[model samples]
Target: MSETIHTGGCQCGAVRFKAHGDEFASSICHCRMCQKQTGGYFGAFATFADNKVEWSRGEVSYFVSSNIAKRGFCKDCGTPLTYEWHGDGVSLAIGAFDDPDKVAPNKQLATKSRIQSFDTLHKLKVREDTYGVEQSCVKLQNFQHPDHDTTTWPKE
Candidate 1:
């Protein structure tokens, strides 16, 4: 079972959040709106009660994608963070989690809208981490936020 509390944020460290308690649902959505928002084939999300999430840093700007739903993203960096439905509770982006594997999805939705490429993703070539170093492309420094939270970001 996953931990009771999980934390994560945007790629730029502009936003951070903590999710507490069990999720109502966890799924990968293949809807067009989700795809366009994430600039990917699908959007993975974990549904939780409104009170379950606490914003530990930065605020999110919401885009009204449809009459019944709105998308929440980092206002500064435009990292897609959430999806809220009219009647359903909020859903946090799986990619934004510090440990996405821990909160693995048990379901998938809007499968008809799923692109053909997604079904064949497993056939793609797998590369090891050493590939970057071997190609002399490994970064000497990483400016992105670490997986865990910190007292201050972008430490000097």
Candidate 2:
């Protein structure tokens, strides 16, 4: 049987990766370190064996966040890509995936650090009415990399 292939990259398309085979875990980490790395309430990730991942495009820069772990990211765009623990497999940020929905978080880690507001986040009202104003007043062109592999980026 053929193994599943999952692709993803940073915001600027400077780095890309492909993960083969099934993931070991999908989780949302609410630890302080995770929040700092993602600049968000939590860090969602999908864990895979180290050998199963391949850097298909540019290289990834890493920061040794702590004595036990390091974080991988794109130096060009500062996008968080991976969380790797010493002697352990790597976990890729869920949002960095081409189809983030495919790797939904199945569990939550560091629950004690979870933000209080997260409990009521779903109660917030949607602001769909702003779409008209945004479209009319702003000339927005998306510079973000598309959610799939590209032959060459930035259209030189």
Candidate 3:
């Protein structure tokens, strides 16, 4: 079973939050919309049930980015926080967590439009000792499963 986990905030610490519930699947979305939203090649997300999340410090500003998903960010710092699907539940931005090491991106979604730079990003190796021992050294690329797709995503 998965246990409750917590984390949040922006670079300056103006916004904060506490998320609860099991650590669900993490994913890297390479869709153009996600790229524009994050200003990066893609966005990293850690999924969770809606009821499992709570805002302990600041209110989040939500934008309906798509017909099926709503993106959330910190009102104070414009920190991209979450991409919640109307039917698929919430997927928190991995960077919002206090320790992003706890989550691992499992799959590359919307690979059809993935940028060439994304290849370089993937080549960057994650050094285990770089972050610390308490946090595991597992890389998103290294994670594997027999039933990969079925286990990592929620059914809409």
lDDT against the true structure, each candidate: 0.89, 0.92, 0.73
- Model 3 regions more than 4 Å off: 121-156
Q: List where candidate 1 sits over 4 angstroms from the true fold.
A: 1-3, 127-132, 135-139
Q: Runs in model 2 with CA error above 4 Å?
A: 131-138
C-alpha TM-score for every candidate: 0.89, 0.94, 0.71
Order of the predicted models by TM-score, top scorer first: 2, 1, 3
Model 1 sits at a Cα RMSD from the real structure of 2.5
- Mind giving the per-residue lDDT tens digits that candidate 2 earns over 69-94? 99999999999999999775889999
Number of the top lDDT candidate: 2
- Tens-digit lDDT track of model 1 for 1-156: 866888999987889999998656899999999999999999999888888889999898899999999999998778999999886478999999999987788999999999999999999998755745855655466678889898887786
Q: Poorest 10 consecutive residues of model 1 by lDDT?
A: 131-140
> How would you encode candidate 3's per-residue C-alpha lDDT over 1-156 as one tens digit per residue?
766566765543445666686658889999988998899889998887777777665577888998888888877668888888867567888887877877768888999989987679768978765555435645334322111113221232
Judged by lDDT against the true structure, how good is candidate 1? 0.89
| RMSD in order of candidates | 2.5, 1.5, 12.0
Residue 131, candidate 3: how far off, in angstroms?
23
